[model samples]
Target: MITPSVSDPSPRRRSEKSRSATLSAALELCAENGYGKVTIEAIAARAGVSKKTIYRWWSTKGAILLDAVTELVASGSPLPDTGDIEADLRTHIGSLVRLFTSPVIGPAYTGILAELLHDERLARAVNDELVIPRVALVYQRMRGAQEQGQLPPDADLPLAVEMMYGPLYYRHALGRSYPDEQRIETLVAHVMRALRTPAPS
Candidate 1:
């Protein structure tokens, strides 16, 4: 009988470290030089890893940027989940606005979103990893409220999610304004009022 050797899990940790290093390097480059100027060789040199290692992990610069964005969001922000739906939604959107408007993240986010518009793979990654989870959390909270009779049973969840996020993103992207507490409070009031109003039969 042939004996099989068991592999150590420490390699997994090392791999994760290498991946993180590469992602951090990519984000720094993107922040300093924009997406067009970032190259695999620059990322490898910044990360202190070989080009082959980066190639082994990701196929394109866009993939590296996507991973970097994912890491940034995951590490820097915690999505709000306070018990009150309106307050939680407002807090969540406000946090996002802060993140989107930050000096380090603002430009990177805009660049990645532009790439996502043209690349289906990048679009799916952004939607699945970033957008869906946050939206789904809010949706779950709204559903719970409906079950408790706090919100109307016939409430439109997708529309509600859009309502919570759309205006904030629009103002952030186009208007170049950071949403302050007053703006968040006003949005919360409007949304709550809309929820309370009975839909026409």
Candidate 2:
């Protein structure tokens, strides 16, 4: 309604508006009424689109939520490349800790992750679409560190990345105690130690 819904003559413009509306509605509903209570019908109603319109793009409610999350994640801050791997990891991981605790996206994303457990198809798509791409970005940063002799050349980057995030993800996904600044700092310290990066001499 705000942006010339009276309406855009271009089909692409109409599609873009509809997509944005649907994604926004999904996030709003999830935040207002817990992810479990967010249904496709509710999203369609709130988005001002028919159920068929939603289904034409997404197979299920989870798929819609996944797309919503991917859009938000894509717009978020990228990993810092200040050239000090330890400092960079701390900054990046700190951002993630905040993301896990974020009120808007946290609950919705946690729900999608839980849904992934029962839906094998969604799981594969999430791994391929969301998780793997983010992981790859970190790996790219660590590879740079290897070239600079910050992390050892043979460092187990994948496992080390896991070590950085596994505990935090476990707590956040399970709705456990929060990962506050101190807790995140402690985690970063522990993982950096495991990397065996040389200290400034």
Candidate 3:
């Protein structure tokens, strides 16, 4: 009796292709119909894959969306890292504002924030996968500033992060208005001022 040879599929390549297709379809559907209206069936249809294929990898639509947004934000843009902390932060925040204001991203962001309000799991996933990495980058920059004596030794890094991000997120997610260049510049200046001032002795 002849025996068939055992062979394993290329897991890395297969997984990469699967992830790419899923993210592409998720972003497309999310942009077109908003996240609330997108279903696994719709994403699978757009991706030309079986629903089982998506479900095999992701447990929920939000999970798929989280991955999709992370990929989109990471791929299209490089986070700013100028040696000057204030300049770098202004560049970073400006890029963020442009991203949030884009026609392709605005609605998707709004949808994601809306879902996050109601879904703890999805919120956690988004925070872990996307927000934390970027936040860490900002923190690293702040630490570097402290080391360089650009910011006071006692600067509150976490509060500084919130100060930089709070206005941008609030304006975009709540007010539905994009931050203008002047607003971004002012934010950077204010944060820099706060960073420079020494904490009360």
Best by lDDT: 2
lDDT on C-alpha atoms for all candidate structures: 0.78, 0.82, 0.80
Model 2: per-residue Cα lDDT over 1-201, one tens digit each: 546555445678778888889999999899899889999999989999889989889998889888888767766636888988877877777777666567778878889989999999999989888888888988889889889988787678898888877887788677797667777778878887877864455
> Superposing every Cα of model 1 onto the true structure, what RMSD results?
3.5
* Runs off by more than 4 Å, candidate 2: 1-7, 197-201
Question: What is the C-alpha local distance difference test score of candidate 3?
Answer: 0.80
Clashing pairs in 1: none
Cα lDDT of model 1 by residue, 128-150, tens digit = 88878778877887888788777
TM-score of each: 0.85, 0.89, 0.88
Model 1, residue 70: C-alpha shift (Å)? 2.3
Give the range of the ten consecutive residues with the poorest summed lDDT in model 3: 1-10
**Superposed model 3: Cα runs more than 4 Å off:** 1-11
lDDT of 3 by residue, 1-201 (tens): 554343544667676777788878887888888778989999888888888888888998888877777776766545565668888888888887777777676667777878898889889988988888888888998898789878888889999999998887787677567768988889899988987877788
